[model samples]
Target: MYTYIARQAIFDRNKHVHAYELLFRDGESNCYPAHITPDEATSRLLTNSHLSQGLEDITQGKPAFINFFQDTLLHRFPTFLAPEKIVVELLEDLDVNEQLLDACKQIKQNGYRLALDDYDFDLKWQVILPYVDIIKINVSMFSQQEITERTPALKNMPIKLVAEKVETYEQFQFCLELGYDYFQGYFFTYPEVIRNKSLPSSKLNLLELINVSSAKELDFNYLNSIFERDVTLTYRLLRFINDPLLNKSNQITSLKHALTFMGELEIKKFIALLALANLSDNKPGELLKLCLIRAKFCELVSAAKREYNNPPMGFLAGLLSMLDSLLDQPMSVLVNKLPISDELKMALSGEPGNLFNYLQLVRALERAQWQLVTDYAKLLQLDELLVFQLHHQALLWGNHIHLASQSK
Candidate 1:
């Protein structure tokens, strides 16, 4: 029940982000299956994002572009999204007709903007041009000649043109030269790497704090000294523990007091998540969300089995599994730097152990491989239905924590 959504950034001519296009993902496959109707697919996605996953947490306050089928558009199914923060994108397959035109006009009158996705300048599409605020041209679908032939007519129109599927710097340059107002694709993620790049001092400090906090037995005096040295870290720690969801009866006055009350596991999870969020300032927030889901899933599985005496060990292993991707370093190197147990390290490295088994189970669950999930559940002596229930609960738990952290 983790509602997964994939978002790709849309950038303006100068490479500044203008918006994000949200794609529906069911966690089982990357593509939206043809069997599911657009209405059903979008309805599920809207519910997941608005209710359970948290839209602001996903988009981070940027305007989101979402696809709308002809039926959804005519029926005004997107009333939930604010006019200022959402752009209704008309999919390529939509038929241009009197009914669709009337619906588009109504949407415009209601103060919502419209964009024609994967647009081609054919005469059949001319009727909707007046209602469109933007036009997305799929670069991968058209040849240079076709694009050249279409540009003159497109230039005459008032709508802005965006180049989609721009996968190379050369393609980007060509699109820019052709007067595309915006661009989207994989070009931005492959920037040249600087040699011997290392984590920033701030990230290094946060990592150290997490490592210290994750210790099974935290020394209150030592932790307080570390917190005292960094006012920001101390404030964040205190603010987090004081959250109403934690349900503390009294206000926490000092670091040592909160540490004693909340215990090391809770503190460690909070610190690690916070540190990852801070370090991932430039990357997609979904990566951090995935990490949290994995950690919570592992922790829940261990607790359900009543094994691994230290539940935090499983959580720690799950969280650290993504460090290699986040830090752009090898997993072994990053694992060696943390002050965690050898068993946890072995588990993180895919060695056979108690924690590793849970990690593999979580991975299988994520991919929706029910056969493997059933196998693992049977091996662990867990009911398959209960495992599914726990995974869903973990998604909700992780999403709640993620939203709270964002509000801070």
Candidate 2:
């Protein structure tokens, strides 16, 4: 059996982590006697170090609790905490039985924090209410209309309110304005309107040339003409073509072969991204390192999960996802002119958003952005170490590609 492990950080609508490293299990297996998948181990992921560190960063308080829940078995319970570090989260679908209630009450008496996930107003489940320290509300799950109408009832409870799924900056602002204490989602990365900035003429020309490249029935000479016009682009193009990374696949020689091998449209897109990357020439080495990490991370998760039909697209999604971060442009604006698929475009929008959810999940994992990583990684069927190794490979490939281009 293969499984993926993810660290879940449980939050209230107010965006406080009542529980960090919440484990969840993933991957498929019925083989082993143990019968545990990696995903299952981490499904309610608990890592003492990562959780404590996360708590300290968020609450600036002393560690107060330490315990581990192996499914229903509560083991490794520590004597005491300062009423901060540890928080217990009731999974959204946890059955509300007397036994569970007793467990909740006992944990509360032991001086631990608690939270409820995706909580919608239900007076029946209110039995668990008094025990929970925080409550997470999905902004999308409950309409603005619902909150406006229901706040009066919700205010009667002692639990703190946390808002999840704050997708747009406007939504985030609205939630904050509406008194939501916590925020989660991709709003931080996506701007309301991606500002368009004029590129250097040389850079713009590269983008323009690549955009014009034909995907089918291409003439190598004509395609090469575009690169010849820009010495740097030519250098980078040839470098990527013949680099060790490319060497493992096929030894690319001549402009026509490059065009044919990469496909005209893909070549165009790659060149555009390459030029976008060069926008940060002075800082390429550092950014390249990070971009490679993200790319490789996404590729591994996607590849292992078997989600994408065209595996290379997943790989490219990881690789090119950082174009905006590199160019200081909103990816939407930059990608508008590229020839890549819509799914690849969606990856940049953030994971679980559209067709690129897997790729986006990979991005989240690399940054350790726990908000969407756990759930999505569960879907990807990839483990952390595999993701890490893949990210390392991406860095190596990117470095070779970068070096080869620079040499030109």
Candidate 3:
């Protein structure tokens, strides 16, 4: 469940830090796993860094250079990341096919900066040059003479040259003379390591309870049985149900009556919100608030979509989307433990599915990607004003809940 991310500094010509490329670690080793797709790994890393640990704390307000696979680019996963705060780094191994080219064009049009990572220029790559803002050439991969000869006279192009793996002062000088605009490698320093401290069993159990509550087989009996075992949860449930919104006339005396009156849908939201609040203890409060907003946003969107009748799953999907980051666990591991549907799991895994698209739209709204948000809203046939209002209401609701909790 432990997570870690390292950041290598990217510097401008004046030797000041311009940006950072986030590096993922599989446990103690600071390397991406060979087993999973790079997209999943990067997604998990970004979830942890941006959602769990605030981006400002990690990047110090500098733009982050994040790696993305062709799948991620095609699916527009990077849309969740703020365009002004990220430089999407395209791996060197991706094929220059039509789909990839189209995705590159779309990313550029969306106002995001792009970079070619570990570049060894092939003639086929020329097609991507116009769309990319930066090109990173690995200095160690080639000899000095080869680098000198292969370095393109791209002075006319509106792009910057980055010299990667520059290991010494002499190599830095050589790259600078070769018109490299940015430099990265041990020639500067090693990446700054950030570790996720281990959580106690009590906190993990809270996470487990939250995951268990997200199951599709949720019912009054199942929820009652679970709540009965935990007095604190029972108390919180009764208190939440008796709030003026649910019980405006009479005070609820018993848990069974509370469950009966609140209905399964309302009970599920209560449990998700309470469980999220509990599990997010010691983490940033804004994370829990954001999750709640996303949960409501997805639920509203799903209800708006007449094609799908299931809104509870949509709610759970949004609530649990950032659970991995909140708990510092891989989403695959966490979602597998939940008794949720395969469709929900697929959505959580960043697979392209119904709930996945909903989650993506919710993410776009979260980052205030207005054009993308408007496009999705139109596609879903949702009123743009309503979408904005729902988002605003969700934010206010989150704030109200937080304030109420603070008062208590």
Candidate 4:
């Protein structure tokens, strides 16, 4: 709930970043704000969330679940783990100096690998020559003349030279010719793009069952038919049903049991939201962050607006609004697959609804687009001064999440 930060370690040829080691094995990812000891990085400069959590987590105390990234690597990894723990970048335009030597020595002593990031070699920057274990060169920044000039000099170096920002397959092949190791960019995502494929009949059956579950009368046979179609989707469906964040008061024994109370449309939207969240895994980090923002706004706005009347559909509408962006396809493509209400559909497509206005307001707030945010706030009948207050509150929540992820 509080905030923290995670640092992106810069690297060179001689050094590299290894995996983040936190105190607890993060359930899904270890590339987080690896727990650390502030005293360990006593000399390093910090800003944003990292400095806040690193200092506080060290001075105040640590729970069993939390550990500093630095501390985690030093304690658990040791030996070859240093390489995975630190980013070894091939730094560009940096000259060799005491500062360079001191940092390299310090990093190496900490059992972390170093890499030169965005490497561009210069006659004067030879100071990084001996210390770099890995070199990262940005191929995108070079002209043909520059490539021809710099390529030959770096040919036979013992250090592993990694070429980054290889956007296309052709560019990747060219970089391979120039001897780049270990790519780190969106090229892999582009290659893995999901093409047009019709939804499986089993999925269709499950969706139909969920539609039936939402009727005034509960249909047990249709609900059972859902699992008979896709049992795996049912497991995720159950998890969504029971997640504390979703405000479930009790554990769900089964998907059918969840349906007894939450109803068909609610179950369908929750399932769809989970699918969208999973789909966002391969996209840009910005895309994932945007999804999180939309998810939060949906939950909060729905809870606020639905006070006079129950409308979980508002939550569904807000989350589904970003479905296109998440799937890298048009919203209309798969929107028809679900049996959402006409009001929810109108809300999603920006026609007009309680959920749509709130979503539009959130988009404006995110851009810091003052005029639109103001106009929306006025229409929502929220006080003008109070609008900024809520905006700032949302920003703080975002900042808190930003810091906590860094905390690991």
lDDT (C-alpha, whole model) for all candidates: 0.74, 0.55, 0.71, 0.49
lDDT of 1 at 39: 76
Please give the clash total of every predicted structure, in order: 0, 25, 0, 58
Listed in order, each prediction's TM-score against the native is 0.66, 0.48, 0.49, 0.51
Q: Which number leads on lDDT?
A: 1
Write down the RMSD of all candidates, one decimal each: 6.0, 11.1, 16.2, 10.6
lDDT of 1: 0.74
Worst 10 residues of 4 by lDDT: 19-28
Candidate 3 yields a Cα-based lDDT of 0.71
- lDDT of each residue in 1-408, candidate 4, tens digit only: 122222121122222322221211111122132453442332122222243344323212211111223332233322322233234332343345575566566656665556666775656546656665666677788875687668777767777666666565466566666656555433432333345755555445544653553244445676566566666666766665665645448788886677667766566545545454445444444344444445555555555544322336545555566655555445565556656677767776677766678788777655445567658777877654554444434444433332322221
User: Of 2 and 3, which scores higher on lDDT?
Assistant: 3
* C-alpha RMSD in Å of predicted model 2 compared with the true structure: 11.1
For candidate 1, list the clashing residue pairs, or say none: none
Better candidate number, 1 or 2, judged by TM-score = 1
Query: Residue 61 in model 3: shift from native, Å?
Result: 25
- Order of the predicted models by lDDT, top scorer first: 1, 3, 2, 4
Best by TM-score: 1
lDDT tens readout by residue for model 2, 1-408? 243333333333443334333232332321112455332344333332334234454222422222233344233232233444655656666667776777778878887777777787776678888888777778888777887777656667676776667666677767777666555454544434456666667766656553454132344566566677867666677676676655567777666777777765556545544664565463424345445545555555655767554325555565566666555577767777666566666666554543377566655654455546556655556564465446445545554554555554
Q: What is the TM-score of candidate 1?
A: 0.66
Q: Is candidate 1 or candidate 3 better by TM-score?
A: 1
